[model samples]
Target: MTAMASVISKITAKNQVTVPKQVRQALGLKEHDQLRWIAKDDGSIEVKKANNNDFWGVVMEQQRRYGSINTPEPAWGPDVGGEVID
Candidate 1:
């Protein structure tokens, strides 16, 4: 079996961490891509790319289930006018 190289990253004050370039390249990750973190029973965390279609499917299903409830109308009416400032 081939051995894998290890990379390290530090988390910022805002609790944001950057993925190492090697790991990103290995995973074929790109900008604006989503990741899911899984916490294992052994207290280890695993990260994987999130499936966009599954995410959107859940969103659409929730919308279909509760789309109309407690929705607010637009605050401004068509007759309301405002001057544009340069």
Candidate 2:
């Protein structure tokens, strides 16, 4: 196994930091790619590539912490709606 080199990046005044070239290549990150910052119980932070299908992870976490979200039924019915004509 090849040893990974440590790289450091400085956070700018706007709170943005550029991912190092080596790190970006290793993670297969491209322009406009999304990353998720996860805070661990050990006071450490982890950065991982964000997947579009991971939205359920957020919903499940919210449900576990604060119970499922309650959404109210629509106030208006189809009969009272301004139906669009095709």
Candidate 3:
């Protein structure tokens, strides 16, 4: 019989997330299965399926945003609040 299922995972108070049982079985994933998170152009996070040994196997490209940010930049230069040492 074929095995496959769809489910949603929730993050815990400790910033930990658990994969549903059905999904784990379908993806052949067990505890400690390595996964990677990516930020899209809209700043939305996407979770992609990956192999444990392939954590750094794939290189992610930079996303470009179409609009300008309305936030102001911090004025923390090289001399913020520390002493200067030449």
**How well is each residue in 60-79 modelled by candidate 2, as lDDT tens digits?**
86799998678887777458
lDDT of 3 at 62: 19
- Which stretches of model 2 miss by more than 4 angstroms? 1-3, 58-69, 77-86
Q: Write the number of the candidate with greater TM-score, choosing between 2 and 3.
A: 2
Candidate 3, superposed: residue stretches over 4 Å from native: 1-6, 54-86
What does candidate 3 score on TM?
0.41
My TM-score estimates for the predictions, one after another, are 0.61, 0.64, 0.41
Residues 1-86, candidate 1: write the lDDT tens digits.
23468778999999999998877776778999878788999999988877777977678767898884467877785776788899
Q: All models: lDDT? A: 0.80, 0.83, 0.63
Off by over 4 Å in 1: 1-3, 55-57, 60-86
* Pairs clashing within candidate 2: none
Ranking by lDDT: 2, 1, 3
